[model samples]
Target: MKAIRIYEFGEPEVMRIVQVERPVPAPDEILVKVYAASVNPADYIIRRGGNEALKPLLKLPMGLGIDGAGIVEEVGSEVTEFKKGDRVYGVPNYLDGSYTEYLAAKATQFALMPRSLSFNEAGSLPACARMAYNGMVEKAKVQPGHRVLVHGAAGGIGSLAVQFAKAYGAYVIGTASAHNADFLKQLGADEVIDYNTQKFEHVVSDIDVVFNATPTTTVDEALRLRSVPVLNEGGIFVCTHGVWPSELFKGLLAKKKATVSMAGVDVNHHKIFTEVAKLIDLGKVKAVVNKVYPWERAAQAHHDSETKHVRGKIVLQIYQED
Candidate 1:
């Protein structure tokens, strides 16, 4: 099997496409013949050795992607939802590998690929879509007519958040560059603000919830939300990047009379994951694929995602379709 591996953390060059032994399914796992996987900020963060907290957990010469779509080549004894040849998609357990020709993933982490989507589209859904669903539907508690604001709306999780907010009947406002204004609008954002030219804090108010999807490095940009009274009494602000520390964030929210919650998608959202797939299958939700790179170009795909300007998900095609 061929997989993308990082020998040492630094630049994207450290990521290499190499031949490796294939993974075997555990009792509750499934062996998938990977067709495609998506690049995420987490991928670059892990490759660059930036996530020191996760360092001990990441095996050296580690394989690189989390979200993927593939066909089930084999299923473990305990698996019941899927069988051989079933098309599936989801984020592999962080310890498992997805940027490979084959991956053995926990059966619980995956769902059947939406009937309406292709491998590439399914590959784009898991990490970002799960995060979006968690923030919009879970933490935000969005209701019809709620006003939702999404920062970095053109990026992967942000784009998905915009659509999910609207799908839940909230009025969505997204912040992006001028080039992405139309793109956000097409995703059903009620309004798109070009953050480069306009100050979003000045133009919007009374937001029921705000979703922060920027890379965790942008502390200043994330903190700036506090300057606005976007949240109503007891309203919540959801941070997806794990940006701020607990005590300080709690104090800040207290001062503003708002509550703050931080989250990353977990196994708890399996039902939402299935619901998202149902939406896609019904043509109610869509995967916005911005680019596709060959498996060998996995490093370049990471580079593109790091630029923080991608309009949607960037994917790597792992298998050559004949």
Candidate 2:
């Protein structure tokens, strides 16, 4: 087997492909022959040594990816949900890494890949789609006829959030650059606000649910604060990046009787993946792949992801699927 490993954290150059022994499945696990894996912002963050609190916990010579799609090569004695030749896609153990020729992890971490999608597309959905599903459906509780607003609506998570909101029959509004306005609409956004030219807070109001999918930054923090006032009374605001400053935003939220929630991806939630797979197969949702790189070019893929301008997910093809 071969895998992407980092001996020490610094630049993307730190990641290297190396020959490694194949792993055997545990009693409740499955071994997948990986075809494709997606690169995420977290990958670059881990490659850059992560933050201060996360630095010491990271071991050297670590694997680099979190999600992927592939065919099942083998299954454990106790695993009955999946068998040999099952086509699956989902999160792998973060420490074990998905940027490899083979991945051995608990069967519960995966679900059937959408039959309508290709390996590259399926590989791109696990992490981002789960985050979107958690925020819009589980946290915010979006419903039919609601007016939903999604920030960073052209990016990986936001794009899926728009589709999920539409699938639930919500009227969707998205914020992105002017170039992606049409793209957002094609994804079912009823309205598209160009964040570069017009401020979302001024243009849209009475939002039933506001989903903030932008990366955390000083500017985005301020934007989150501004978004709260636009929500209708009793509306929900879900932030995937992190929670805003409660002290500053509490008064505004109280005035509107709105609630704020922080969303996190649950990698072990097989049921959520199964439900989402149904949506994908039904054409209610689709994967947004920005680019696909050969697995050996993982360093280049990380460089592109760090730029923060990619409209969707960047994937690494480990093995060509027949």
lDDT, candidate 1, 1-322, per-residue tens:
7888878888988988888988889989999999999988888888877575786777687877888998999999999988999888887876566888998878888888888888998898899888888888887788898998888888889988998888889999988889998888988999998878987878888888888876555564445445346666666787887556457666666876887767564536457678889888777679999999998888788788888778899999988644
- Score every model by TM-score: 0.94, 0.96
Clashes of each: 0, 0
**Candidate 1: 10-residue stretch with minimal lDDT:** 219-228
Clashing pairs in 2: none
* Maximum-lDDT candidate: 2
| lDDT of each residue in 242-319, candidate 2, tens digit only | 435566676788788988887764434687789899999898998999999998898899889988888889999998
Whole-model Cα lDDT per candidate?
Answer: 0.82, 0.88
Per-prediction RMSD in angstroms? 1.8, 1.5
**Residue 177 in model 1: shift from native, Å?**
0.8
